[model samples]
Target: MEYILFQKDDFTEKNYIARHEEGSKDDYDITIKGRATISHGGRELTIVNVSVEDVGLYGCRISYFEEHQNQYYHKASQKVFLDVKVPPPEWRSAPILRRYNQVTDTIYDGDIVNLTCRVPGGNPLSQLTWSGCPNGSQTDLSSSTEAVVQLQFVASSSHHGSVCTCTALQKYASPQERSSNVTLLIAHPPTLDIMASPALPWFATGGNATVNATLNCTATGGYPPATLSWVCKENSTQNGTEGPSLLSVFPYVGVDDDKMVCVCEARNSYTAVKGRVFKTIQLDAEYHPQLELTALPGNMIKEHDSVRLMCSGHGNPSNITYRWEHGEWSMAGSNQTILNLNRTDTGNYSCTGASNSSRYGQLITVQYLPITVNYLDVQIAILETNLTEGDNVTLECQTEGVPSLYDFKDWNFQSYLMNDTQLLNGTRGKILHMENINYMESGTYTCVVNNTALVRHGSKLLPILHSPKLHPYRQASQQVVAPVNGNVTLSLYIVANPEPKPADFVWTKVKPDNASRNVSELASSAGLVSNLTIGNVRESDYGEYCCEVANGIGEKLKVCFNVSAQGPPLAPTGLHEIPGRTTAISTQVQWVSAFSGGLTQVFVVEYKDEAGEIWETSASDINDTGEGKNVTHKIDNLTPATAYNIRVKAKNSYNGGSYSVYSDVISIAMKGILFYNLLNENLSL
Candidate 1:
């Protein structure tokens, strides 16, 4: 047998030292070297046969040249203890089992292992056998009085924690059999898998910007357990040690996260050689559909005209479907993208797509203004009746037509004479006002409305009966108030023997220059009463309005009123903390302004610590000049290491109106505290 004490290709020469007893001061005889053969540049020492005399410590000294100093010295040295066995008279001891290296009992899967069982001092060479270990080859290295068996096999995960037993049997001994056992510790890489909370088809519902989910990485079947970790695009890497799984929280998963890949990795002690195992998952998300309704061949639909309305939808899922509805009922059996116009189609049309989101289109009115005179006769309404001679009267004509009568025609008046109607010169507009109407003027009066493409007439009989005393009266002026971007209605009640004509109801606004501008175009009449609506009122709309009435029976009466602008301002928008302006004790907040509601408005800044429920107004009375302008305010006296929620609101000056709704809440943390906490966590890790 050969024993290599020390081997190094770089060494120049090697020396050997032997001692009969380990840890003894006596030096071994140099003559013993003559019986042993040393080869391979003195690296190996071989003896033909080994005996108990070789049981001692052997030391090796080697000399190697140092390139830096250019010198060779016997500086490197190593020593190993050796044991020798011989035949014994009778069996006395159990077998000892150990691996070839005798360094560690742990082995990795797929590794080759060699175990030896030796029994010393046994008569008739006690039989050495291996048990518990399967699929292993055994070799006999027996002497006259000793028994030895070597077992070799490949390690596997199944062999972990299993006991490999070596037994020595002597039929003549008092103790017939003795055994030694060693537990095998096998290491293997783990299998990895990733799981998600609220598992697939992630939907962003409730108009939320992002949907939150949790990802867990699990490792299974590894000795010494496995460490799990996660890697994501939007989140920092996280790890878990010797656990069933590692969790990663995704707080802001949106439609953009679709197909985003996230990785989970697992490793163990054996993973160094086998490499880490990982599993990946691509996010699948479903978001609300974005829809647009468009009309084909033009939106001005006419009766019996063909129309196509397309509902274009975009969303995460590619298989989105659509449905069309008109007014209260679905368009049954109709094309999903088009609807033919009918004479009765005069209401709203809407569209709905997958994701169950609905969108409304503009009001559709089917135009049916034909040139037939019956159309006018069926649609016209006469405003005045019961006329008498020598009495002033006002007549109005109401009709429906496409493009509006005001835009398509200038109302023409005609009178029936000699059993025929002729155009009455100097008579214009939808209303006819006659002064002191006499029997000579009594006849059938007609109101003519026409465009370049069509013409129609609406007429009524004005017969003289008997004369009666008449009086014209006007009501007092009233006060009206509204806010900017709001609507206001100016109403007037009139009483007279003959009611005022629709054209006689005039509205005018007094300007700051003391000049009057006719706003009569905004007026409409239902009977004896007239209403003038001012929509989306502006700053210039605040003033006095006057209504004048003339019936040829009394002096023209004038009614005047003042219109005042007042209301709360609109809510502040785009509230956020101004970056690079926040500190440990103060932070600057910014927002965009909205309408002032026709009154002077001021902004109020409010904030509160995350732990507190009550919000504290940090700054109030911040000056604002106009809408759509960015405004900023600084809040101070804040504590460090604290998180705060901030918001802004607009209030009317002099408490004229209510405060506007609060802006969106924003969160801000003290600058240094975040870095400090992160640094501490890293240090602790």
Candidate 2:
């Protein structure tokens, strides 16, 4: 028998695997190749250390080929195919567990990872599996390459950046496996926070304008450290090194907006475009209080009308207060005030609104005329008191003022009937009783009442219908004194039949300079009375003023008044005495000129010692140093160590009214250091 190796029924001349015939054997050299073997049994051929070049179809054939056929046919052959493959370069390092999650080269919590591992082509298809997955976590295959194992895992934070590994196992003469691991590098967008570093107050009250307002922005929690940036309204930019950035600014107070808005951006480089966040906040800006004024009831801020003022100031810490001041009067209310309107209410009113640290104020002047009748007519007139033949109808007049004269010395009241030319008695009370009434008794009646203490007066009129014989009585005004350039009134009080015409009022003035002026043009007529008003009274006006009043049918009545100066030129007020500046042995005195009698003034300062010796020196005789309306004098070389009483009075060269009543006595204690020192030296010697 012969054993031969054949290749696909064709014989090769040089290649030999194994051959044996009848106890004689030949083998492929195993020492050089190390993977091929041939047994001397001549039955088998094997090759080790497989390579690509060893793949082919082989056949074992017998050359006898059924010898009976003897036709030289090739022997019957059976064939088999041999394959050799290595483990595909160790699976290419398990495919580098990356290429997802922004290429961070890692897996993170809540990440869905698809990891592929290749076992490579080997003697049999390799096996693939995974490990390090959380307990009860199901694994699924996303897809795979030929000879590669792929697995997808849904991760959770509970995975906690643990190892995730995919392994490949090759089925060879010895099972070999390889694994690749991925440690997660979690990425997150920055959690951003922005705030005013220190809150700003609502106003700049008590604080300088250079106060720094800072805004802070921060970011944290990302794969790479986050950076912060800021943009402010003042065209400014700020940057931060790591997570937090700060921008500082100064507010312009009232010149800036009431609020400040700032924005900050935070992002991480590793997270690319998706890892960004922003935050914003508004802060209160300091400013001054803004004041507003409001009035109610109308613009007619007049006497006897209800008027109110409201002042408001707007600011932070909203508890603001308001004060309304008018000269000597003031009201305190947070926002509003109402004051009673009086004759004295016409003046500048200041409204001030204040906060804890700031204040705003404004002033307004209120002016209005009093609501009183300037005409000579009374407030009430009841006409048509009918009195005919023998019908006595008593006419009464009602007035507002309580009578302070007429019957009682201090009770002032009067009633009269004006007829033809004389004043007829109207029963002397508020009521007029007419007996045996006739057309001749009908006339106009006047009632006047007054209260001098309160400076109030009231009067009324009643017209009796008929043609009565009228009688008139004359009453002259009393003497009056007024300030220079002030007003004075004199009248011829009367009762007459017909209303006194303007021609009936005659007034004249004789000046102290012996000049005369007719003043009837300044006269006004009202019923039975006529008045002359002297305006712009001058020093020359201090003299006799006379008036002659007559109805067309009555006897003329005449009266006169004596006008005087406000006071003697030396009348002094606000008087005070002090020790002389140079020496306490004498005294210095000062006084304000209350009235200078419309002329230049000199003061008389009198001092009396306890010994009944009196000394007098005029302001003109001493120091005449003072501003207008003030008189100051110093008396030197007086008796020392003596108690003295000092008083002051005023006099004028232009008018020598007696010197005014003396000022209150001011007792002075004299200090004579020179006298005391001399006495001490004498005693010592």
Candidate 3:
């Protein structure tokens, strides 16, 4: 028989064998069968039932027997080991205990607290429980397997000296447990009492004395905690909160000490316990004696002046006395004191007050005085009534004052004066004098009078006058008037005493006929001379002119001439000639005088022969245009052998005025030089 151990369904085939000697073969018939077994330290281990203690080594073995020998041989097989493994179980420690939080020094009535127990290092389990004996009674609690647990509604004061436990359970180890003892301090929340220092008396004056006070309070024990607040009893004013069992408040002064109380309150939020305490203090009131001094006409006393003084003292019990002292004077009165002062009495003044039986007295002082001026008046006058171009003027100043006096003087025209003398006339007066006066002396002059306490000022100046004149007449050259036919301006040379003076100018025209015509008159403060215009000029207006200047002092005149006309021939318009016998000879001439005039009479045409000799025709009467706009003239019987230069002029009969402009010259070319000889020979034959 043979056997084999294997896991479930591990073996697939089985074989038989016999033991034999080396190199020799002996055949024998043998049967083999496979057997298996599995074991473990605990119950049958399977995947579904795996655990930490079921893990180990596992093995399988095979065995058989030989039958060729007559004697049967027994052989044992090697041992097989089996191992099983399991996973560990989950574990955790219990929660840790926190320090106890106290609410107040004293706990009363309904108070609650939390007690906790914690454990560590455990697998698969822990439980917490609370046990206590308070007020002769025990608290019962059930065992729990939770990591943390809370106890609620613990309003009993009898829960003092309670024990709380935390237990941990492990699969193969002893169960662990942690325990703590809690002492429930049973007390009211806390009672606070506030006390003010220097307690008040029952009866006192209303507002005479100041009251000083301090406040204090205390808090007792409780579970969660308690706080203290100090409040004023009369006004319900909260002062402050304190944490310690005792609190002190800073000292304070009050206007009146009546109806004053301090309240101390304690509160615990964790429990419904509160406590409060209050105290009343009394204070005595008294009126302090006061001394006051008043001078006549108010606080300000004028310098070097006199004043009447009064003193007053006030207190309670109608036993007040007053004493007044100013400089060397002193006096006493039951309720008032009076004093009279002078300049020597200008010193520190004091007043004292006393009660009938008191040892001390109150005092006040007067230290300031008003300001005053003994005299404040100023007078000013010029040193001289008559002033010249380079003469000095002086001003005198005066003022009045007492012991302390001053003098100040200044002049405005100091630049023009050679010697400016400033002198002190008296204790409160001055004198200012200018050494010279000139053209620059025309300004405001001021003199100032001053003292240590006041000032005065005055001013005066001298008036000056002179006459202005214009110079004698000087001739001006003739002028070529502008062709545009506007006013003819002529300037004159003249002089006046005051370089420039207000003057009037008269402009006149002197015609060729030696007659003068006043054209216009102009007035100007500036000495410039100008003439009024003859708007449009004609041949009649071409003549000599004069400008005259005058002032109240004198008058002067200068002469010049204007040669102008409105329109003349721009060029020679009729510049042709007439035919002649045996000679191509003609006259060359120009037209003039586009406008008829008052003295217009004769026209003169001048020319130059081809040999360049100047020649003139006798003055000829020109017929006025039928429309009376212009004049025209003609000349004849000229030799054809000559070329000519020609210009025209117009004249006026009234002034013998001549045209300022000449007509454009015209030049003629002869047909041939022999034509003039032929004309002369033909005429002779």
Q: Estimate each model's TM-score.
A: 0.33, 0.38, 0.23
Could you give candidate 2's per-residue lDDT for residues 23-117 as a string of tens digits? 55454544325676655454566666666446657665433234565553335357788765555454556333433443445544456766555
Once fitted onto the true fold, the runs of candidate 1 whose alpha carbons sit more than 4 angstroms away are 1-106, 119-123, 134-146, 170-178, 191-202, 207-212, 232-236, 256-262, 279-286, 290-319, 324-351, 355-685
By lDDT, highest first, what's the ranking?
Answer: 1, 2, 3
Candidate 3 has a TM-score of 0.23
How far residue 283's Cα lies from its native spot in candidate 2, in Å, is: 1.7
Assess the local accuracy of residue 391 in candidate 3 as a C-alpha lDDT between 0 and 100: 64
Candidate 3, residues 283-339: lDDT per residue as tens digits? 332244544566665544434445555666554424666666655766776333233
Residues 526-551, candidate 1: write the lDDT tens digits: 54577778888777788888777655
Output the lDDT of residue 362, model 3: 33
When 1 and 3 are scored with lDDT, the better candidate is 1
Q: State the local distance difference test value for candidate 1.
A: 0.65
Which structure among the candidates has the greatest TM-score? 2
What residue runs in model 2 are displaced by over 4 Å at the alpha carbon? 1-86, 90-115, 123-187, 195-203, 208-210, 221-227, 231-244, 251-259, 267-276, 284-289, 297-300, 319-340, 347-685
